[model samples]
Target chain A: MLMRCIRAEMRKLRGAGIWWVFALLPVISAAYGTFNFMQNREILTNGWYSLFTQHTLFYALFFFSPMVGVYAAYLWRMEHMGGGMNMLMTMPVYPFCFFAAKGAAVLAVTLLTQGWVFALYMLCGRTLCGLTGWPPLQIALYMLRGLLGALPVVALQLLLSMVIRSFAVPVLIALVGGVVGMALVAQDAGIWWPYALVLLGMNANRAQDQLSGGLGVYVLVCLGFTALLCLLAQALLTRRDVRA
Target chain B: MRAAMLAERIKAARRHDLLLAALTGLLTALCAAVRPEEDWQRAVGYSALTVNLSLMNAVVMPLAMAALASRLWDMETRGSGCRLLFTLQSWESLFGAKALRGLVQNVVICLAEGAVFLLAGRMWGYTQALEIPRVLWLMLCTFVVNAMRFFALLALSVRSGTQVLPLAVGLACSLLSVFTAFMPERLTLLTPWAYDVPLSAMRMHYDRETRITAYEPLAFPAGLLAAAVVCGVLGYVLARRAVRDQEV
Candidate 1:
């Protein structure tokens, strides 16, 4: 039943528009990261994952996560509007599977997007700096770090989608947050806010002399919160009015 | 009856777009005011331009062309307000009117803010008299780029129900627009802003090695501004079709 539910979620996610949304991740990441990489090509040589983690991680948390969050919310909104929730509720499956399937799908789509972006980014790097030796593990770790931070944003979007019927609101809210949040967070570089994970990863990857051991504590806290958020999302999805 | 129908749309738009515009204008100016003139490049210039691109294009303008277009076509989810403008308006005229109004209002507000910014800059003495023309030209080009933004955003918004994705896409495109600055000065012969201002005329090369050329005109804002008409018109046409088909 759970597998079926997840499959059904994937079916809706296959919508052409959603694919375009997914496609946006790499294009945005690559385009902007390229600009940054060119602007300061020195720090980028640490490796694929390190450079991306450093340059793109900060963006993933604040702007990228929020933007992606809206699309995540929009994914469920399809079900909400199509009356899929009520239809699924009648099935033999536990309703928790519904939210889980949807959330997992969003995560998968995000990974696919970020993954493609990573590939394109590496290509850009090679073109510019004659770089080689694909460090899959490091890049994977960097992506994992970004996904860990993305949990709260995804959870928040899901929670908001349940209450806010309008598909328009999430993007606006995310924009407001990204614009304002970056301004505030740019001040304290070491804070454990979900947006800073990429910066931490990037800094850690860069392994520059400027960083210290305090970053490990920040990572532990972020991962801890990410787990808590997943639990919170599952609980909310189980209890909330799916029909609304 | 046709006149009445048009009147109703104008009213409906005023209700949705006008209040939002005024509020957004105040918010934009307030946000811009918080930073000192020295930080203007980061705060107002790059950030505002970016958010306007990668973020909410309509939120900044209030009566964004997309909202106007979407509302006109009824692809947007229904509003709580029960008005005949929702039912009676044709998509073509509706989008045309909305796009036109949005352009005018956005430009006016932009000019007002520009004036205030200049006034503030003068009072603070951040620039000299010689720099005023260059600044004015930059502002003029930015205004045109904003026009393109309105066009591009409106068209995309009508096709995509979620306005943010398109806005972000536009933002990404704006970033891509920077690549034009890298073109050799002689290659920039196509547009008025680029032609009149001259790519070399506006500090084409940034000596970032020294970090002193941060104020240099990294790209021809005029070329971007000139693209506004083409992008805007194309956006309008696309928006009109989308609205007609109820595409979003």
Candidate 2:
């Protein structure tokens, strides 16, 4: 049933033309990142590491989470409109399956975007930066870790989009969350904040692995937040009256 | 028109549009409060604060305007309220009411931000005298930029019948605005979203070795400001037409 729900969600998204959002934002970020890196070449001499930070700085800090918000909002948009919520509640599928399906769909898109961002990073590092030996193994690890870190954000945004009928409000919240997360990370409190996790995981604007000493805590926090959001969503789905 | 505007206000009140204003104020305060104390002691501290505040505005305003403009129209789009509402009122009156309400909200938000900047400066115990005129200038520039964005997004929402496009474009514009700070000045002027920083009354320079940051006053960019006004008027005209010609 959950598989069926996931497929339904994917089907709804087919030919929605949202892929351009996931594609265009990173290209813009990469363009800016590479330009900034080149302009400050003398100071940013860490080669691929410096280049990686440049690429992910704004992408992680500003663009990525909001893109996730857009996807989550789009997924729930149809459901929130004109008798759709009532129809959804009447369906035999468990609310958990309904919510999980949306999360999974958003997760799949996020995973693809993360890989694309990394691909752009590597391409820029090699062709633009011009000195790359297979790109460091740690960079791939950072990309993977960034993907892992995005789970809680995806969950939280999914939950928000579910509750907020306004397509833009949830996305605005994500942007503000990203800004607040940047502040929290600056105060060395990234692991505790779900929005900060992705920034920490990406090691944005820094050459060193930000979560090196606290990787376990980071992973645990991500899982904890995701689980909490899931429970909240389920309770809201099963207990609350449909707004429609 | 007055009746229509009053009705728009009542609708906005019920919709809790003021919350977005509060959010904007709170964000400005947060941005102000987060600066380190040491930075406030420098000779150019107040000017530096102004520059930073402009950058923060650049980041925050696009999304806020997008959300506000989208929300104002989304209610009508949902359940085909636009058709029902059009039956009762002229499209020009309806469009004017929304635009006027949005303009008023934008003013309130800018005033709140300027107030917060003043309050934060006082709390931080800065000795530099607060320049009321300069702050007002910054606020006015911010209002212009936000009005432009709000109208653009409002037009898009009305035409597209979907809030997603305006919001997505808003997110993209926010990202580009931040990056615009890094681009050449001539190029930055071309992107309306990037106007907050360029229109700022002060600019900051940091000396890497000495680690001293200085702020210099800049003549207000009248040409860009005029361009923004032109774009905003164009957006208003387009949005009005969209409402007038809307099939229902």
Candidate 3:
């Protein structure tokens, strides 16, 4: 049933033109990152590590969470329309399956975006920055970790979009959350903030590994937050009366 | 016109649009609060606060305008693409009402932001006196830029019948504006979102070695202010046309 719901989501997303948003944002980030990286070569002497920070810093800090908000909002938009939520509630599928299906859809898009960001990083590093060697293995691990970190954000945004009928508000909240996350990371308390998880996982704006020896705790936190958000969403769906 | 404006106000009240405006102001205050307190004690502390406030405005205002504009139009778009609303009122009145209401909300946000800066300076026990005129100038600059962004997003929301496009553009503009602080002045003038930093009454300089930062006053960029006004008028005209010619 979950697979069926997921398939239905995929069908709804067909030709939604949301890909342009995902495709365009990274390009802008890469352009700004590359330009900044080239202009400051003397100070940015850490080669690929410096380049990684340039590419991911603003993207991770401002763009990624809200992009997820857009995706989640778009997914739930149809349901919020006339009589759609009532129809969804009456369907045979459990509310958990319905909400999980949305999460799965957003997760797939996030995975694609992470890959695209990595591709841009490598492309900019080798071609634009004129770096000679392949990106370090740690960069790949960062990308994977970024994907892991994004799971909680995706779940949280889906929950917000589900509850908030207005599409733009959730996106605004996501942007604010990202800014707050940056502040938390700066204060050395990022590990406890759900919004800060992706920034910490990506190791944005820093040459050194931010998680380092605490990878276990980071993973546990990400998983724990993801589960908690998903359960909260399921509970909301099960308990609330259908407004539509 | 009065009735239309009243209707817009009623719609905004229902949607809790004032709350969003207040939230935008609070977010700016929060961003201002993140600066180190030591910097606030410098001789040019108020200047530093002004610079920081403008940069924070660049980050927060564009998206807030987008959200506000999109929410204003979302009701119409959701209910048969304004077909019903058009039957009752002229497009010009509808556009004027929304534009005025949104501009009023933008004014509220700007005033609240200026209040935040003053309150922060007082709270931080700044050495320098707060410049009332400069704060008002910054507020005016922010309002013009945000009004321009609001019109552009309003047109996009009206045309697309979806909030996604406007929100995406807002997010992208906000991201770009953050980096614009590092770009050259000429380059910064080209993007509307980047105007907050360039039009600010103060400029900041940081010494990498000593980690000391200083703020200095800038000559007012009257030409840039003129350009922003022109762009805002153009956006408003374009948005008006979009509403008038929108196919029901």
Candidate 4:
């Protein structure tokens, strides 16, 4: 039943004009990073992982999380409009199931977008910088880890969109999270901050830097925080009376 | 028209829009203050502080203008307000009032930023005395640049209907503005987003090898003012057309 609901939610998003919000950030990030890489070609070494890492640091630091917020907000936009929430609540389905299906669909889109960005980064690096080594396994590992680290951002943004009703607030929160995350990346405690997790995870995979001992703890924190937020959202949705 | 302008003023004040702008100015000031105490005495000079603030402003102020414009415009378009707003007043008057309010708010915020620079300079042991004319000129340039951006956003808001599109575009431009400092001079003149680049009150001459630095006034206030007038008229025309289409 939940699978059907999720499929139905996905169908609603077809031709919905929200895809650009998902695609723009990654494309811009990769293009800008590629431009910078080429401009500094003399200074930068042409290794595959090295080139890929330089481009993606800005992505992980700034674009990835906020783009997730945009996706979540786009998904919730319809339900927030024109008595739609009240109408949905009047139906016989469980509120948790209804929200879970939407959440599932958004999560899928988020992961797909991340994968596309990863592939695009590799393609750009190979073409522009004469990257040679396949490094397929390393690339996959970084994508998987960064996607894992982004789970909490997805949950937090979903919950914020679910509750806030205002379109810009959730997105601004996510953008501010990226700014705060960037600031925290300079301090020792950045590894513990949930907003900074994806950044730290990406940094751990860089070819130049030795993987810090705290990478394991960072992964655990991301998973734990995701679980907590998901549970909190579920509890809140079950209790609230839906109103226009 | 007077009633419409008054209504717009009340709505703006009620929404705490000015407060948000003031807070942004303060935040920009705080960002400028991130220097060591030793640098604070010597290196944290007027032109240097202005350059730092201008760089931060390039990243932030465009989006802030977009947000403010969208909030003002979107409030009238969300749900029942859309239908009611059109019926109550001519769209021209409404648009005019809102645009005026936005322009006034931006000018005030620009001045507030200038005031912040003066305070930051004096408080941080800036060696030079307050150079009010140069600081005011920078403020004027910022105001003109933001006016152009605000007008562009107003046009976008009228056409897009939804709040997200204008915002997303504005933010993308804001992100691009971060790199404008490094852009070549000819490119800077062509890219509307790079207007802030020319407004950098600090003229930096860095010796790539020797690494010596010097500061002078770097501003093209007249050029920015001319651009503002042109973009402002274009925005007005576009918004007027959008309203006409809505009426049809």
Separately for all candidates shown, the number of backbone clashes (residues 3 or more apart, or on different chains) is: 3, 0, 0, 0
Give the poorly placed runs of model 3, Cα more than 4 Å off.
B34-42
Per-residue lDDT of B83-150 in model 2, one digit per residue for the tens? 89988998889999999888888988888877776776666666677788788888889889889998
| Clashes, model 3 | 0
- Check candidate 1 and list the clashing pairs: A54-A202, B53-B171, B54-B171
In candidate 1 the C-alpha lDDT for residue A180 amounts to 47
Computed on C-alpha atoms, the DockQ of candidate 2 is 0.63
Judged by DockQ cut-offs, the docking class of candidate 4 is: acceptable
Please give, for residues A82-108, the per-residue lDDT of candidate 3 as tens digits: 878888988888988989999889999
Q: Over 4 Å off in model 4, which ranges? A: A135-139, A204-211, B5-16, B37-42, B45-48, B79-83, B104-130, B203-221
Q: Provide fnat values for all models in the order shown.
A: 0.04, 0.55, 0.45, 0.08
What is every candidate's alpha-carbon RMSD to the true fold? 6.7, 1.8, 1.8, 3.5
Per-residue lDDT, model 3, residue A98, is 84
Proportion of true inter-chain contacts also present in candidate 1: 0.04
Better of 1 and 4 by TM-score: 4
TM-score of each: 0.66, 0.96, 0.96, 0.86
- DockQ of the two-chain complex in candidate 3: 0.61
lDDT of 4 by residue, B93-120 (tens): 8877888888777877786787777677
Candidate 2: docking tier: medium
